[model samples]
Target: HQRLLCEIFNEICIPDLRSNINVDRILTLRRQVDALKIHRETFEKDLNELEDKHIDKKRKFLELNEKFHNEYAD
Candidate 1:
């Protein structure tokens, strides 16, 4: 009985098990790769936008400060 059961399992179950495992691994890896790429792109764009805003704000503040002091001094 044990030998018969082992034969049945080897013949019928092993391929199904291995194929399911391979499909699951491939699908999970693909999803992870896609998600990582998307996240990286978003982070890079966000960083660029923040830096641009910071530079603009600093320039405007400096201009306003110089104008205020020059007018008050005159």
Candidate 2:
């Protein structure tokens, strides 16, 4: 009877311990995901700003090129 009780206790407690570990892992993964999301947003914003600057510079360059060609046209 004592051995049977011990077996029953072990069966119940082991699964609870395993579930707790799984929950901890899930929480850690969720925190990592949140951090990655923030980083991705920051990177995307920086990329967009760089792209806008590049477009503006390209437009200015094209305008200058056109003006030079028009002034020197024979």
lDDT for each candidate structure: 0.91, 0.90
> All candidates' TM-scores?
0.64, 0.68
Indicate the worst ten consecutive residues by lDDT in candidate 2.
11-20
Which stretches of candidate 1 lie above 4 Å from their native place? 1-21
Model 1 C-alpha lDDT per residue in residues 1-74, reported as the tens digit of each score: 99988897785644465455667889999999999999999999999999999999999999999999999999
Number of the top candidate by lDDT? Answer: 1
On a 0 to 100 scale, what is the lDDT of residue 4 in model 1?
Answer: 85
Error of 2 at 29 (Å): 0.2
Which model scores highest in TM-score? 2
Model 2 Cα lDDT, one tens digit per residue, 1-74: 99998897775644455455567889999999999999999999999999999999999999999999999995
Give the Å error, residue 34, model 2.
0.2
Candidate 1 lDDT at 44 equals 100
lDDT of 2 at 9: 79
